[model samples]
Target: MTRLVDVVVVGGGQAGLAAGYHLRRRGLDFVVLDAGAEPGGSWRHMWDSLHLFSPAEHSSLPGRLMPAQPGRTYPDAGHVVEYLTDYGKRYALPVQHGTRVDAVHRDGDRLLVETDSGTWRARAVISATGTWSRPFLPAVPGRDVFTGRQLHTVDYRRPADFAGLGSVIVVGGGNSGAQIAADLALEGDVDVRWVTRRPPRFLPDDIDGRALFDVATARRRALDAGRGDTGGVASLGDIVAVSPVRAARDAGLLKASPMAVRVDRHGVVRADGTRAEADAIIWCTGFRPALSHLAPLRLRGTRGRIATEGTRAVDEPRLHLLGYGDWTGPASATLIGVGRPARNAVREIAALWARS
Candidate 1:
């Protein structure tokens, strides 16, 4: 039997949950399917000491307000998960957890979405699966030759996991890399080494008038203007341009080289003439979207991402991708910035449903 709905939202994180809530509010029927056993995607996989750089007030979903707090700093990973769980209950969102979507394809006018659990027939599909679906690790020559343990930042959860490891190298200069180095330095006895590109320009936790809000608003407009795609020109004004480098430097976590040429049992060879040896290498490189289940959908784009605009599906009107790059705007991939895009997506979906 093909279970029918006005829309089917894939991924039960903040973006997925937000989209589902808005669709419901617009008097539409939709179901949210999440890969994790619970809500909150990266929040569930984030490190123990991880905290959102954005303040809670600005990080709240569309309708719900985050719990009041004294500190203006961003909420920690646990706080984020708790907030999302509350958001789901408050809205009574119909989210099906532990339902990993296996494939998504078009069945003529409708979309056929199959999961490990069951198949659903939806007029629209929201791909809120997120950009961090799979952790990306660059392939370096002789990488497997390294004697020490190697892992991506996604697999890392606690500092205790690295205890007894004498020395560790944290690769990448982004927030994850900087935070991981700091965590290991403070929590364990291991000496921390950072392999990164340029140092990030770290802004204050709160920049001009709540930086998160400012960034989100700017990104929303950019998305609406259809300038949020991957290939779109980089208009630095639209994204949060703050650098995390100063923070990394203050923490003594900055490395000289950005590019990794190769790896061997000895150490990592730098693009310049240098080598770094360590007992473990934690690659904090970004993630690539896992669209294996989307093979049946026949998405054609420069990258694997499915591109769409203003509710009219790219190739198939019935197949709408919710969380794909710039689906709402340039920064739709972020936790705090995702709400507006999610809201926009649901409204677009509702309009489509109404016309049918």
Candidate 2:
């Protein structure tokens, strides 16, 4: 028997939980399906030393404030996990844990959500599966021949894993790359080399995720108003100089080189044909959206991402995507940013049901 609901939220992470919050407020019958055994989502898998670029106050969901840690400016990953776990409990959101969704397809005015446990027929589906499960590593020539250790940022747990390595290269320019490089260089005996496609942009020392969010909001408003210039605002891509990164910079270890062209048996080969010897390569390249469950719908546009207008799929209105990042909505992947889109998505879904 197929259970039916007004809506099915395909993830129990920040985005899915936020959507659940609004859906409950609207008095909609909705169920949230989480693949994980626990409630924290991807935050539970983050490296131990990781901390939010923003302070707790600036990095919160819609209703509850993330509790500030005593004597700590930025909350660690564990703190976020705890907060999310508590938030779900407080709201009593209808989240089904350990239920992995396999596929979603159209079933005549309703969407069929097939899961490992059972199938749900929902009037609408909100996909918040997020990117953590889809880590991306760029292809380099001769990569198959490399005998050295290679891994993506998703697999990285601690610098101690590479402690005794002779040389290590960290490939990426984002916060993950910078922070991981800093961690390995500061805590390990390995020689750390930072590689980026372009020189990384670092935000001012006084700025943080709060400032970045404000700028993003402003830019979003401007774009909505059909105006262009955002007055040269900083982007989220700019690195926030946390203490370890700052120390690494001051110690002259944060310097980056151009991306390597190929991998050799011993190490990576530069564009200029020079080779750098390394025992391991950590690719912090980033992730693609986890939209595999929606594959049967054939809703993807270019780049395998569903075309969205403020969370609703452009082609399939019944399908909404959240937490996939800026393409779906401004700052949709962050803790502070997911709420607005979630509310918007729920409002649209409710209105659709009203007309039916």
The TM-score, computed over Cα atoms with residue i paired to residue i, of candidate 2 is 0.97
Q: Over the stretch 257-302, how does candidate 1's per-residue lDDT look in tens digits?
A: 5657888796688888588788898998877766677787677587
Cα miss at 73, model 2 (Å)? 1.1
TM-score list, all predictions: 0.87, 0.97
Write model 2 residue lDDT over 132-165, tens digit each, in one string: 9999988889888878899999889998888678
Which portions of model 2 miss their true places by more than 4 Å? 229-237
The Cα local distance difference test for each model comes to: 0.72, 0.90
Superposed by TM-score, candidate 1 places the C-alpha of residue 307 at a distance from the truth, in angstroms, of 2.6
Give the top-scoring candidate (lDDT): 2
TM-score, prediction 1: 0.87
What is the Cα-based lDDT of residue 341 in candidate 2? 88
* Worst 10 contiguous positions by lDDT, candidate 2: 229-238
